[model samples]
Target: MEQFYTDERNVQILIALLKEHGIKKVVASPGSTNVTFVGSIQQDSFFEIYSSVDERSAAYIACGLAAESGESVALSCTGATASRNYYPALTEAFYRKLPILAITSTQDESKIGHMIPQIIDRTVQPLDTVKCSVHLQTVKDAADAWDCNVKANKAILELTHGGNGPVHVNLTTTYSRNFMVKELKRERKIERVMTYGKFPDIPKGKIAVYIGSHVRMSKSLAESIDLFCETHNAIVAVDPTANYTGRYRVPYMLVAQQSIEDENRNPDLLIHIGEMSDMAGIVGQPKSVWRVNEDGKIVDRFQTLRYVFEMPEHLFFEHYSKSLLSRQNTYYNSCMEKCNYFWNNIPELPFSHIWVAFRLHNLLPMGSVLHLGILSPLRSWGYFPIPSHIEVYCNQGGFGIDGNMSSLLGASLVHPEKLYFGVVGDLSFFYDMNVLGNRHVGENVRILLINNALAAEFHLFKQTNLTKVNEIERFLSAGGHFGCKSLDVVKHLVEDWGYEYLTASTKEDFEKVYERFITPDLTEKPMIFEVFTDVNDENEALRRMYFIESSTRYKVKNAVKNIIGEDRMEIIKKIIKR
Candidate 1:
């Protein structure tokens, strides 16, 4: 058997880092400088290599592979103009935000000014083509190997950090025909940990735990987080999709509704857990953020990430909480006060999507699951509190309206004994309506479709930029896609698919029929409760909710103005609003 491997320490380290990061796909173009790299990786069973003679075509092939597989793809080429051939495809990948790793092999930098074959400067204007670039020098000692390892790790990680994009690694080879090493050396793995090898010291100040869209936590994990918050005088900030039913749960809507003068609400240390959250802007920014996730990549969603703890969240919290001294509950109390203030003063809403959610809040059975559609439904339900036993889920990872209903149906199949309620907009419900005809759907599923006849998200002032544009309804809002203001087709289709269809257009109609839809015993089949509301009422209800949470100065001015005559208070009200 032919011993197929490279003895070059830097090339071996680069390949080791690529395998460690789970980058398996390689598109190798014909290159003499990269013979050691291409030859070494080809013999390894960990990588899947594709041959492309043209460097330009190989770059595009890597792009397609990365886009389709949703994984990072590496492209290798020789030095000089072969590396230049990658510019067109790299520029395309940069603008599209695709993760492509461009590995260009070249001769030593000392030969760049001389008349050496295939020697070119690869560092000229690097950021114009890729997000970052790293130079891996030939390793001669342990220090050189360590430096190469660090640079290689950083170059691979930059492919997905902050946002996904292409990155470059220029490897200098000496053209040594040393292929005698049968096995690679054990490489050093660099783990970036905040509290390395010991418990973390809890900072004494306002600390906030912001949980994003996550699945239901285990009881042990939840208890550990709860104890951590209690011991440190921290508040757990959660949106509806967080599904954290612990004692320290504080909905982020309360914080968003408050005025900026309440600076005490800001956290000195914000600890982030879980995945992407739709309430990024709604939650107040922290002075510094410490992220805890298993992936261990640096994620600066808040733009103030000071530390990243790479471990299981439960282990980190349980260990850190053990080192804490009991502190005064100033932060927790302040957050709860604002939450209670909003809970007590919730205005009576009209027959809108939010109104329906509020009316059905208490009726949702315990030990059930609620799946909210993106945008409108998720935002609406985030304002209210759910029962501790009720688990919440949303497709906020993609944040698209495409798979809401289908995902709810899939969840219902797995937990057939538990009740599953999905609240979606009309566009979302109809887009995945074919899932209802599948044979696997059970009677435990209940869908609440809020048909506003258009994409109402476009009209929200806080959510979209199209609020100021003319004819927004025609193009951006996707108006008239599912038919205009008619549920006859929907009713006929659902009834034919063995579903019990219910429609409620007014408050009285909703009150009479909502109880039947929510009752598990009464619903013999999967039900669709279609509620009709217009865009104007929906927008007004949102505005009214914000007004209810307005600053004390605005509330006092409005109260005094309402007490006096309407005509005299108009100008003062405009000034106060401004």
Candidate 2:
């Protein structure tokens, strides 16, 4: 049989990244599962191989090689009883600060609980054994390949990150007999530049700087990003929680609703910054993504990550903005011009979450704090803007329906004199309703409970498949829970609990009650404003996001969808595309 690499993508990525990280030394033990890994590297002259028949001796040999050469050494062995021998050597590497890549190849993990031979659960390791361990599962798609690429890079990087230490790669493999493969497909290598390294040259293309759930940007950091945007013709795509109130900051949630093929909307390079974010319902596929964070760990959100600049985001922008000549803002202007189409047109919507958001978005008093429930409230309000002085917060960390009200109440405690407002669904309100009885809730706390008696989020986007089934309300949407949006149910309970309850069942009622609910002035008692709507209207309002009411293109498409029915129109679209 001709020598070749394994068809297994997980092992392929690990082997590729090892060479990319410049690791050449290895100690391999005889094994069935790791034959793919050890076999692949053995044929290449790039690796200086040392064979150890005993798995116990291989890890210790790796430690010695790494320590003496002052370079990372790779160790390979099979699963079950093989990797247990690595602990003592790994612990030594952990304490002594030596970089050792421990590769433990395992048979299919699903066979473990089925009483299959040579199967064991090595999912966890002792704290002192290694600095970090990442398990790479079977790669079936681009997402899986990207995940393997990232995990491999992190395990390799940890060899020197924060101090040298052993890192474990618990890789799962599907046993394959075919071995005619000629080459290792080129893999994505993400280079992490340290503070001492020079920043790479910016690629000349349409650049998008994505700012997700970031803390408030300092004046200098904001200025750095602004100058970079001006110099490089870049635009900042702001997640609602990004809090980057700069001239180049574009409200992107609505713009994201546009077509992905829109050249004016998509970017060639997407520079990601800050924490995990709600990128649901977004469009456009960037050619590549680069992440910037202080932690220096690889976070491949878009799967096309090319580099990770592990430093302060301000330093990255400031370094890039050094230009003697001023550049044009054509890219930024193009994106904003596309976004303005949705902003300038205000369509008449039925009483729904988005309708309420449109009415109350700019009406909220400046310098106030606004807390929102996840899913519906975040998506609705993301289409608009909050004043830079108004601090926006949510349980975006957990993205749960619970604790939204609790978060608002607790945040109000920090500044009792400042107005604190919250917009939560009836489901969230009912789950955390017990908190209302707490006497500590003050007059500064204001709550808006939008009660549609339906799980609008669960049903809206899934209308296609879910509607094909029956009895979806009870289970799919979890609808008709907690008083089923009865007008008196909450009003009576809250009133008795020392809260001033205001209920709105129609747009007229909302018009009458909304002014007092959002008043910046504090009332004698904490207030609850409950607005009610129908499930149909809620879904319709959400569907309007796809069709800008003013555009004749979308208007005609919407008409077709209505006339021929959504299901048939979808079929027609598929045929048209083909």
Query: Best candidate per TM-score, number?
Result: 2
Per-residue accuracy of model 2 over 1-578 as CA lDDT, tens digit each = 68888888888888888888899999999888888888888888899999998877888999899989999998999878899988989998899998988999998777778888888888889999999999999999987887888888888888888889999999887877556677878777888887778777888788888888888679899888889888888888877778787888787787677543366555788888878678622425777888899888788777778888888998888888888348679987877777787888757788998899999988888778888788888888998866667777778887778888888999899899999999998888899999998989999999999998877666675468776667777888788888787878998999999999888888898999899988888899999999898888888887777666557766687777779998998798899999
How far in Å is the alpha carbon of 197 misplaced in model 2?
2.7
Which residue pairs in candidate 2 collide? none
The TM-scores of all predictions, comma-separated, are 0.66, 0.91
Which pairs of residues collide in candidate 1? Answer: none
Candidate-wise lDDT, in order: 0.83, 0.84
Q: After superposition, how far is residue 488 of candidate 2 from its true place, in Å?
A: 1.1
- Expressed as tens digits, the lDDT of each residue in 75-133 for candidate 1 is 99988799999999999899888999999998888788788876787767446579888
Give the lDDT of residue 284 in candidate 2.
59
